[model samples]
Target: MHQTRLRITRILCMIMITALMVPLFSGCASKGNSDADKGQTAQPDTQQQEEKVEEKDPVTLKFPIWSTITEDLFTKLDLVNEYKKDHPNVTIELELLKDTEYENTLKIRNAANELPDIMPLKSAWLVNFKDNILPLDDLEAAKNNLFAADFKVNDQILGVPESQFNEFIWYHKSVFQEYGIEIPKTWEEFVNAAKKIKDGGKYIPIAMGGKDAWPDYPFNEFMPSLVAGDGDYWSAMATKDEPFAKGQPFYDAYVKIKELYDAKVMGPDPLGVGFDQSKLMFGSKQAAMIALGQWFGSDLKSMTDVDINDIGAFLLPVRDSADEPFNTVSMVDTFYTIPKTSKHPDEAKEFLNWFFSNAWYPKYMSEAGLQSTIKDVKIDLGTMFNGAFDVSNLKYVLNKGGNEDYKKIESTIKFDVKKMGQDMMAGKDFDKMMQDMNNSWKNARSKLK
Candidate 1:
């Protein structure tokens, strides 16, 4: 009986030991499960952190422009909107202002070192603001342009031209046909054609917008270069003691313009009208011709119902014979620039890459009716200009370089060449005008030296 009791006691001890061991094992298993859950949670946390690092940060760029929103600005706005579709993280803010106000405001902002991210700069103004502009020489878009290589400031390309324009005398094809006038090949022929148009008494030979003053640039600012067959005529004249002498290029060109004025072929009262009025006269077929650049095509297209086929263009024909090399004034009209003070420069540059890409560049130039600055991209400016001059073969005289010394001289003298044109139209003595201009030029040159 005592042996049986001891055996029962040992069995009881075994059961107790087993029950205690079960709880300890259960505790270990619970701790293991907790650690595994934590590992799984940490893995997701680490993945989320990596994803956050890979994501792009949202960026906004500020762009200020000085053109009518409906005009050139709309095309740019459309491009920005299109860019946004591909880059949802990027936004562009456009600041619109009148041209004059924009220039003044930009100048003020530049002084404060707070310029916008992207802006349009005239080639002449680039020299003034190049210190604040970022160099674009490394950009792929800039590298592809035909004219960008020529536009350098201190060996750094600060801007890129989007479009180019050539100066021409735009005439009505129907007008010439109606008057039995062949397209003039020389200045003399052009003058005789003008006289014939005047004698016909049906139309103004040339529409002269004298009241606006700037309308005279074709004759006053550009003709001397055309006559001299030199793109750097004005710059060369800066070194001359008597640039307005009787036999000088400036004097010779002015004499031809004076002859037109004396012949009364421009209009009944050329000095009384402005650019808009002159355009109206030409559009209504009351005038046979107007001298302007390619930009006038858009304006004329909007103002008149005349068919595009009725319009024609020709070089100004300053040379004495048809065989002589004729020079046309060409200009790099608009430049795209990035300011050094930009908050989103990299984003702005990214936008430019998309802007000048093959997908957008051709469309932009075509829609804007501007000559493409991109190599291998040919835009038809219409049959008139296409037939009139072979763009590849024509001698191009670029617009005069901006001279700060001349600017200072102009500001000091307050001599208005446009007003001189108006005076010429009003029968002022050409010789006296020449003498006065020489004296003023001499005075200005002395100050420059």
Candidate 2:
């Protein structure tokens, strides 16, 4: 027992001595402590750096568009708010303007170098603002766009098209069947059918939003292209001195349009109604038909009173004969162009990249009910497109507003075809109007540099 107690005491003293001597060994304890100190201190410094890297400066992008905020494509996509999800520091401010004044507003603002940071221009209007806009040749959005290359000015892509589609005369099929009328295939047939609908007099034969002036695009803006079977007819016309004279496509189209107007079929007061009112007329079944593009399909859906199943579409037949090649407008519209004056161009570009990225573009395309302009990205258009291509010898007319010279002459002469359409609805002498337009165009062309 005495020997065991002494052994236990000796072991205890040795253990205590070893523990006390640990710090004295600088080689082992100091090396271990140094490593431990580094592990403990390095984490916080690394964390602080990570926190710094995660921080981003907030940015706001100004985007102005013609369509009302409710009808705008950006709104449909929830673009402004949606972009803020991943890019919490970014905001897209949308400025809405009337479609009639949209281009003119941009032009007026452009004179002062005050175009919106991001502008959505028509394909025809792109060239007009080429000097004020930035070349987007380097952007992946432009690179992947199928229609972007087609609309390049001076071989430099200035804008990227988001959608490509055909226009149609959206009509009530039930009303057509009720009147014992078939879908018209020629200009004469279409006019005669309108007359027949008028004779019945139960509904307005065709609803027109001539008050807005822009709503007459189907007749005023596009008929000349249809008559010439050329999409770039405006550019082709610039080289000629009297392009709007009789026998010319522009004059001929205007004549046909005037004849339709004379028939008293575009409703009692077509010029008194705006686009929204006209849409309501058609949706409420008070009007048999209304001319619009596929884009109207979404707006049509918004009308809670209308039965979507009853609406059908067909290409407006501008040919005098069904045997002639039927010309259809295949427009690639809404070219997203960034103005040179954008303060946050980098952020704008980043938003565009994110917008056209695979994650967003396809879904947005589907939501808009539009065909994708992105290469290899096919969109399935809605059922309203069925039977729209049942005509023979169809030709596509792609509108490129005009060449450089045409736009210059147009601005100088204040040649507003859409406004002229409104004037036609108000009973202008068609021949005299053409003669005056021809004279103005010739005078403007002579002064071009």
The clash count of every prediction, one per candidate, is: 0, 0
Clashing pairs in 2: none
Span of 10 residues, lowest total lDDT, candidate 1: 68-77
Model 2 segments more than 4 A misplaced: 1-42, 69-77, 111-113
* Candidate 2 residue 359 C-alpha distance from true site, Å: 2.2
lDDT of 2: 0.87
**Candidate 2, 200-275: lDDT as tens digits:** 9798999998888888998999999999988889989999999988899998999999999889898999999998
lDDT of each: 0.79, 0.87
Model 2 lowest lDDT segment of ten: 67-76
The TM-scores of all predictions, comma-separated, are 0.81, 0.88
Model 1's C-alpha root-mean-square deviation from the true structure amounts to: 6.7
**Which residue pairs show collisions in model 1?**
none
* Positional deviation of residue 446's Cα in model 1 after best superposition, in angstroms: 2.1
